[model samples]
Target: MGKPGFERAHHVAFFDAMATELPGDYDKQEVNHLTLSYFALGGLSLLRELDRVNKDEIARWVLSFQVHPEAHTDVDSGLFYGFCGSRSTQFPLSNVKDPCHNGSHLASTYSALAILKIVGYDLANVDSKALLQSMKKLQQPDGSFMPIHIGAETDLRFVYCAAAICSMLDDWTGMDKLKAKEYILNCQSYDGGFGMVPGSESHGGGTFCAVAALHLMGFIQVDLASNLNDSASIDMRMLLEWCLQRQVNDGGFQGRRNKASDTCYAFWVGGVLKIIGAYHLIDRCALREFLLTCQSPYGGFTKFPFDRIPDIYHSYYGLAALSLLEEEGLEPLSVELGILSSAL
Candidate 1:
């Protein structure tokens, strides 16, 4: 068969369906509605068809998730003043007395901000001060951030989300960068890849979070030589080598050693290489061909070529990986931010 071509119209329809209404199979994603919105909105932005959505309506829906301090007076009341993951997670305006029902999450907040920016909404109306206050409370003594104020898994993922939130708001006051840097450094495994936490096994997603967080914190200087090695500096060369190794003979990247390559790692691992300024080291043609194999006949990309089912997460990252390759007709993606250059 000829090289798999992009099904532009079908992909557009896929995103449009997500924007308007999610299918029944997506009911499980109701808790992470903001994340779903991000994937959908980010996909549209990548397709250069963000104009297809009602920007004002989408922006308003996103803002509605924001928590207000004046709404509750309980101990946990001010804990979640950022943004909730979905409408179901949000406390109704009339029920401001119940703080237990309202909880803002770091990842959801990050997605909210990203979606807002992608839709061309000026964040002037965002309650930056309140959001920053919430972010500060989420950071533990160890410098890792919990996904929500109520306490949850603290890992590199939420750390990256906190960093991305602060970067978007142009406020470093939300997190202690020095402590965050220390935590990130500790998460770097002996193999040169980063893990979710100290002493954890190295993984692609964890490495991306750590690297992108450091870059957002201004700890990773772009001018730093990739070959430079010092006791105080991260070994960029070793990290780059580890990332490159994830791209197996199949051309697609695997999240971990001895694992099958997945579509998402194309961005997870590829984004890391791009951030390190060593993306040219990869086999671009083979990687592109591998990604094409994962593209579903219906429109979006699947997790693996044989999976046959497409999802928003893999689809967005697939497009992003293609963007990093400077694929024709695709917008350039900001590796660190994981959004289209135009969106940025």
Candidate 2:
């Protein structure tokens, strides 16, 4: 288990923001999408602040986004459409007032699904077969995945999303496993990490996605390890050594050598190490000081040291990184991680 890093004061303050049911100032315009909402709730749920909020109301709202199979335009298409935004924007206006049926996104689908699982909902309600069928359509021959429908941009992020979806549905037949695995393996740089695309600079976030996907798909051993002995080893000694060595005096983690660390990279690289079974290598005392300093006094968290513009995205990830370190009486998501790991 990871140890606590920062004080309880930070935890209580962050939890309070999550508990406050603020008016929907941003929901209609910006926060209406299920993906951002899911990221927000992920922070709250993983932090155990879900109890402080209305569980029934939130659960119902999340379930409402589920795309019933009947709504799909074609059975062969097997895609889910709809985005959850309130009545705010009149631009890109569709004939239908409701936004859910207008668009579909791979990122949104994965986040929406993850938020449901985080909230303890049963998977029985999900149309797994239809989702798998839709997933196959997005799979490119190169193994990268398009965002939702065909002709969308093919990239590493979508590849990770596709892998996560398959892992969640417990089916790989929907995707070309060999092609996807080959794509991930091909992206590995000379530095032994992955980039957003092949032959590009390595990034911690991209590395995490590639590694986590391979690990989830039962292919990490072959790619990350050298041989059978390395396959059985999950201690992450070597991997942690590489990741931890990337840390500077600050709490953040840098993707490349000698580069300054970013608050977000802390979670990406740190979270990856946690998955590799070596999160304990993080210096909790030092890292906590760095992360807490990044927190804005009004609420929310930021990147770098001593920055003030707090955002939901960085705030959520900052909390997650600290959770990995088990700081501030916060519990890590052992249950969810355990369930996902065992299934692989």
Candidate 3:
């Protein structure tokens, strides 16, 4: 078959639905509204149609999630001043009086800043001091970051989020690069792929987080052999080989060993390969064909070709992966920040 046509109208409609009203199944994702918004807004950016959305209104809505230190002067004051995932995550305002239950999340904060940039908002108005202060508190002694200040998981995903936040803000004071590098190095599995934490199974998403975080922090060396002996050094060659191995014969990538190929891995794994300067080694034509198969006739993309419906996550990554492949009519993506290159 010929290359599948990009159903722009259908994809636009899909993003519109996500931006306006989510389906009933998305009830569980109510707390992650910011992330969902990022997917929709980011996808529109990739489609070069971000102007279709209300930039000002969306920017204001995103800013509302910012937890100001002055406003939240309770015991957990400075700790929760970044940005909440959604309004539902805000205490007092959401009638959630439990101070411990409501707080800013690293991932949400990253998405908020990314969407703001995507919508053409200037970061000068953002309280970078407050945001960075809150961000610093999320980092543990080992350099891994918890999604939130209290009782949250510490993993490579949050580490990437933290790095992206600092990179966008053009400030490194928010995190310790040496410690973060040590943590990332520790998370590398023997097989060369990275995991969520030390000694965990290697995963595509985690690998992207580790590699992208290093890239954003300026720790990635162009000369792979230059940093081999350093305590926090990454085995660039081995990691690149592991990422390359993720691509199956059909052109799609799997998250882990012996798993079925999925659409999102195109970004997760592809992003890693691009960071390591090994993207040229992948079968670009076959990967594109595999992603096209996952494209829904109605709109967006599913995790796999047979999935009945498409969600925002896979849909956005599908577009991003296509962008990495230099697909026609798509915006080029910043592999490290996971945003459109124009946004930077």
Candidate 4:
């Protein structure tokens, strides 16, 4: 592929291929299916590939999965289900018709926004006010938000989701800023990285979420400056350094220590490093090579080196990694490639 025959490929085709190949297996159930599709379709839109898809039909499909605006589900127990493929008529994912559905997930909400925005849909079709209200109602006393109605484990990731939602809406009324910041700061692991929860294992994804949230809040630079006396500032810098070193000889990044490198973690880790002003610390050429290697001849990118199968999650992340590197030939990509260029 000298230059991608991008004009010939389309979003619907990519997603149909993925949906057919990776069905609703136990490991990749309906919820994950929606998550991956959201990312893939949204990624395509940002790449100007939506011209090939049924934008209206795909938009309708996404709206079908939304919890009814009139349902007025409990903020505490009613988790926003990811997406339903005609599975059941449940108000929410957790308790509706079945109990094993897990619950509303923060990741799903995040993915949903990205996908919708990519397709050029505004907040009009969604119960924007109600969803914001629900988000506000779900804030915990500890500042960190939970992902489900019954409250699954509280963590930094949800904090990021909550913050991103607020950022997208251009409002912070839904979150307790002071306490949310406190919780995010508290979750910084000793390794100079942040984790899902306090004192948990440091992960590249969690670190990016936390860092991006803080940056979006306009507190990162000043806070980092003011916290010069605080131990957390050192932790922040150390986290940046750790992320910078994640690039292997092949140019991809790993999520945690000792794990094999993957294309997606490049964005999770590299994007954070970029925000922290440390992206240049890595060997850009090598990382670009690794990401390029993961790109399928068909247009999408795989999760790891030479993995045959490719999905939206990896495809978007791979594009994002290239975006960070600003590779010579490709167009620019968003930090989360799922957010369409039009949305920005």
Candidate 5:
């Protein structure tokens, strides 16, 4: 068979189906429905097939998950007045007196805002003052963020989410920039890759979260692979090398040391390289071939190449990786924002 090309029409149909309603397998993830939609909607946007979705309806659906405080003063009640993951988590304000039980999440907030922008919703109407003011409550003294105000992990992931949320809203008040920067800086592994938290093993997702968070927070400069400036906070040379070494013989990128190449890492690792301006160094032909193997014949991508089924998460990152590679007919992405450039 000829070299597998970007199955544009099939992929569009794939995301279109998911956008209409996610498959039953995802029912267990009902709480994260908005996040799943971001992946599908983002995939459709990458394929230049956004016309398939109704912008107003999707925007309203996403907005419905947002949790606003009862009053402006409630921003200080230590509750996160951000977006919840889905309808189930959207607790009534009357029943949400406990900050810990409030269903709004940092990650969901990021996804909610992304979907809003994807649908061209006017975020100016969003309760920025409340969202930003309350989001600060989720930040710890160490500068990391918990996904929720309650029992949740604080790591580079939520930090990135918060940073993206603030960046999208065109306001930095949502997070303390200096503290977040310090927290992100502490995550860098000695090998030059970043971990989810200080003293953890380097990971592809964590590295992307750290780098992209730094980019959004203005702690690091872009295209460091080409510019090579001394003013950079992290070990630039080592960071670039660590990112470059992720491409294995199969041409797909791996998440961590000695791991199998996964579909999502293509975007996770490749996005870091792109931000550092080192993408031109990749084995483009081989990487494309590797990613094509993961393309599910039914549409979308799977974490592994031989997997039978497709998942919205891997599928979205697959398109994201292709967008980073500038694949023909796909929309370019804002790497840090994780959305269409036009959407911004």
Candidate 6:
């Protein structure tokens, strides 16, 4: 393919189709249907075409995934009352708090709240008391968050979700800001990039999670790019170097060093630069050309330029990356909260 265009119409139809029903290719993602739906709805938001979907109906469906405590005191039963990922994981509204069985997830809760916000639903209307109270329990002594209530991985991804949730709700009671900040600082590698956890290799996604979470939590006082001297917690200069280096020759970004350029990192790494106010330094023309090559003719975007089929995750990020470039006819993306500004 010789430079396939943005295919805005096809991309619109792609997200529009995904909003209603998922194809069989996403069978493994049934558990993450809400998150998947977020990609579609959020994708549409970035494209300035949210009116294509039914906001009220989608809001009702999203709310149904929220797990509720049967009693007010049950919030202390060590169970998370956030939204479950999907119907299959959702048990019949139980406060059981089984270490073996729990439905609600940090990522799912983030997606559900994000979807609600995207569709113009009032976050004040949500059951904040139970959700926030239990969300606190998900934070570990180290300040990283487990996606689920108990016995799950704790890393920067869930940390970003937690930060986004609290910021969206306009409340920080769900987590301790200083503690989360410490955990995030610990994840930053000597190279100035952040890993998913301490001692891991630096990655683009982890870097974004750490940086964006810190920004949402109000840890990055003022544009660090222009005022790096005041920063003591993170190596701002090294971080900026690490991020700018991610943009490969193809103009797309790779999640890590020595990896091939990917579509998602265009958003993952691109988002970090945007948040730090260094987005102006990248090769925008080269990046857009690379992203256009990844756009699927049928609809959506692929991870690589040569791939023909497109997935929802990469497709959403590709559009988001383009939004950062200020592409014509797209809504501005908030690189911090992982949702479009139009949604907020």
- lDDT by residue for model 5 (1-344), tens: 67777888879989999988888999899988888989989999999888987899888788888887665445787878888998888778677565467789998999999989988998998888989998998999999998887758899999999999999999998889889988988999999999999999999999999888888877666655334774247887888889889999999999998899999999999998887777788888888888988999988999988687999999999989988888998999999899999988
Encode model 1's per-residue lDDT on 155-181: one tens digit a residue: 999899999988888888899988888
Worst 10 residues of 5 by lDDT: 223-232
TM-score of each: 0.94, 0.79, 0.93, 0.80, 0.96, 0.96
- Count of backbone clashes, every candidate in sequence: 0, 4, 0, 6, 1, 0
Per-residue alpha-carbon lDDT of candidate 6 for residues 121-216, written as tens digits (9 for 90 to 100): 998999988899999998999999998876688999999999999999999999998889999999999898999999899999999999989889
Residue lDDT tens for model 4, 1-344? 46332322533356446534554453445545457666656555545556766767767766666654335555444444333333332354444566445344566667666666666677555665656666765668888887755566888878888887777666677678778888888878888778888888888888888888877776665333343344334376677667876777666898988888998888899888766666667887678777767877566778887677666677777766765676543346556323634466
Compared with the true structure, all predictions reach lDDT values of 0.84, 0.63, 0.86, 0.66, 0.88, 0.88
Taking the tens digit of each residue's C-alpha lDDT, what string does model 2 give over 9-81?
A: 5545554564454335545435346665665676666556666666667667765654444553574653444
Model 1 poorest ten-residue lDDT run:
223-232
Which consecutive 10 residues in model 4 have the weakest lDDT in total? 3-12
Q: Which stretches of candidate 4 lie over 4 Å from their true place?
A: 1-16, 19-27, 69-89, 92-104, 221-234, 297-299, 328-331, 336-338
Candidate 1 Cα outliers beyond 4 Å, as residue runs:
71-78, 93-99, 223-232
Over 4 Å off, model 2: 1-32, 71-73, 78-102, 221-242, 256-258, 334-344
User: What would the C-alpha RMSD of candidate 1 be, to one decimal place?
Assistant: 2.1
Q: How high a TM-score does candidate 2 get?
A: 0.79
Task: Score residue 328 of candidate 3 by CA lDDT.
Answer: 82
